[model samples]
Target: MERIQEALAKARAQRQQGSATRTEHAAPPKINPSVDDAWGALSPFKLNRALLKSHRVVAAETGRDAAPYDLLRTKIIHQAQMNNWRRVAIVSPDMGAGKSTTVANLAFSFERQRDMRVLCIDLDLRRPSLHKVLGQKSDHSMSDVLNGHVRFSEHGLRLGERVAFGLNNGPAPNPSELLLSQAARDTLEGIEQDYAPNLTLFDISPLNASDDNIAFLQNVDCAIIIAAAETTPIKRIDQAERQVAELTNVMGIVLNKCRYISDNDGYDYY
Candidate 1:
């Protein structure tokens, strides 16, 4: 813990010293109605319970399977509220670490909060899969919105009144360049300005995969690294942690797909 803290402090110091002035842009075009009104206007979609269950998006269930995600939601909300962070990136050291699963569950968990408005954007352009995990398809992908081919209002889908998703239909070409472009920044800023979600979760590519995650990390206020318990190495986690801390605040690490459960951990009642 101490080592992690030290690394975070060092990285933050470096970030502060090297931070560059942000490019100024003209005021973004606003939606006709207010932010809340625009959010309410999003197209609603019905979720398939069985499909969600098969994908292990247990946070939508009423059973004990949802408990862990609820706890994660509480912790994330607390930390984000404390720090005034709205945009959060969910990243991993490599592919197949359940980062997309975590993003889905976490978004559903936030849905349980009546007052919370959440936006989940699938930014994993090279291998987009969040839509499949959620069992939904979109006519316009996030890439289209980022490239100004489609407006977010036209592309985003609403799940209930509280959650909205910016999904991808297929793999996008030249993902890194797209993510780092000024158009990307402008589009993201416009979404935040118009949607005004309490939390905007971006499911990005793995840290070790390419420069895509690095390019997009600059737009987020903080990030959470997801690691597969037995598959993700400690060194990779450390390296990813250091890299994220250098770019933005490190909320914490989440360990997924663990098989062992201690008897004394106190969930037997469930």
Candidate 2:
């Protein structure tokens, strides 16, 4: 909490200093929010296209998977516009439901859209995977930011022009406390104000596995439940749906790892 307070104060002081100095200093070369800062300074490493393809990251080059991500993007945009939502939590009923992969693909897909800003944060404190998924390994992440180890700007990884990611790698002893703390909420709000991303994707832990998703969803706009094709049981899905609905808007369910069958009628998703 003290770290968050100091960050807030530092931000305020910087703003005040900027206003006072004005024409004399010429704003000390502002950090361009539009593009990657430099090589290895503030910008994150560029995602390897080949590695991403192997991981089944949905991109424009991906023939079959692109359509689903495109449709998902459309639906997400429509819902966001309809409900005036800017933040969404991507969660699953249990582990191995492809929640992290879904978030990675969605963020990558959003990058292709013109004028769309997306900030993808790995809030799965128990097992932070975005760093590895995005190929942007970082020593610091949202855990550090929330704990006041670093500020958002200093720790954020800018991938493309429109996409920025805050990733975590280490597990905190008290994961729920980090997400539910006032400092966590304020840190998110600060990042929102600084970056002003159109869509903020919070990749959270499984809803049934722990109370992290429910508690964290209280700080976001909506949630999308991810269910594996055959592994996820109906009762677990129903339970997760009901529980999430009570906390935030159940945006929609993503059926990941679904098989596709092709016949004379072309392709049919089962």
Candidate 3:
């Protein structure tokens, strides 16, 4: 527990530094009134409430199960809006840490905000579980879109007027190389320019899995590391936090799947 607290403190210090740097050089964002129109053009799909609940995406629910994620959504939005951060990557120390579920719930939570536009992308090309979690199978591969072979509009899907998703059906070949390439950066830039989402959440590979997350972290403005309680080791969380802080702003660490929270402790649920 001491190690975890240390990691959190380091992350907070890194976030403060990143915020200062961005504030020093950040320019005012351009107002794009057509952003809503762009989002509206995407094909809309209905969310399966039952399927989402089964997959642990309960942020859309009005119950206590949704409280933690709603608070997470609020914190993320506050930090992003304050620091002019638009791209955020969600990663974990290792697989099975609930990274994908967190991304989906955040998307749903962001969707409830009528004025916020969100783009959820599955950048975990090695496994790509986000699509399954969202209960939507994509006909298009996100890797193809990143490689410039397909346009985002052709490969993306929308929910209502605010949320868009870029999902993948299968794993990509040489995902690390692809993420490190110039094409991937260009593709992301184009997407942000065209879609104009208030926030873009990337469900990327775990930190200890491979170089894929490290390669792709350069493209995002900030990241949050999700660690599973009673499962993820404190040393792993510390290492992952350090790696992310070196690459981008460390927003904070999320302790997921906790089973032992006191009745009075609501803020530490996630």
Clashing residue pairs for model 2? none
Give the number of colliding residue pairs in candidate 1.
0
Rank candidates, lDDT, best first.
1, 3, 2
Q: Work out the TM-score per prediction.
A: 0.87, 0.81, 0.86
lDDT of 3 by residue, 54-84 (tens): 8888886765788888889999988988878
Could you give candidate 2's per-residue lDDT for residues 181-208 as a string of tens digits?
7788778866765666677889999876
Write the number of the candidate with greater TM-score, choosing between 2 and 3: 3
lDDT of 1 by residue, 19-121 (tens): 4421121122233458768877888866898999999888887657888888889998898877777778999999999999999998888888887778899
* Per-model CA lDDT versus the true structure: 0.82, 0.73, 0.82
Residue 129 in model 3: shift from native, Å?
Answer: 0.1
Clashes of each: 0, 0, 0
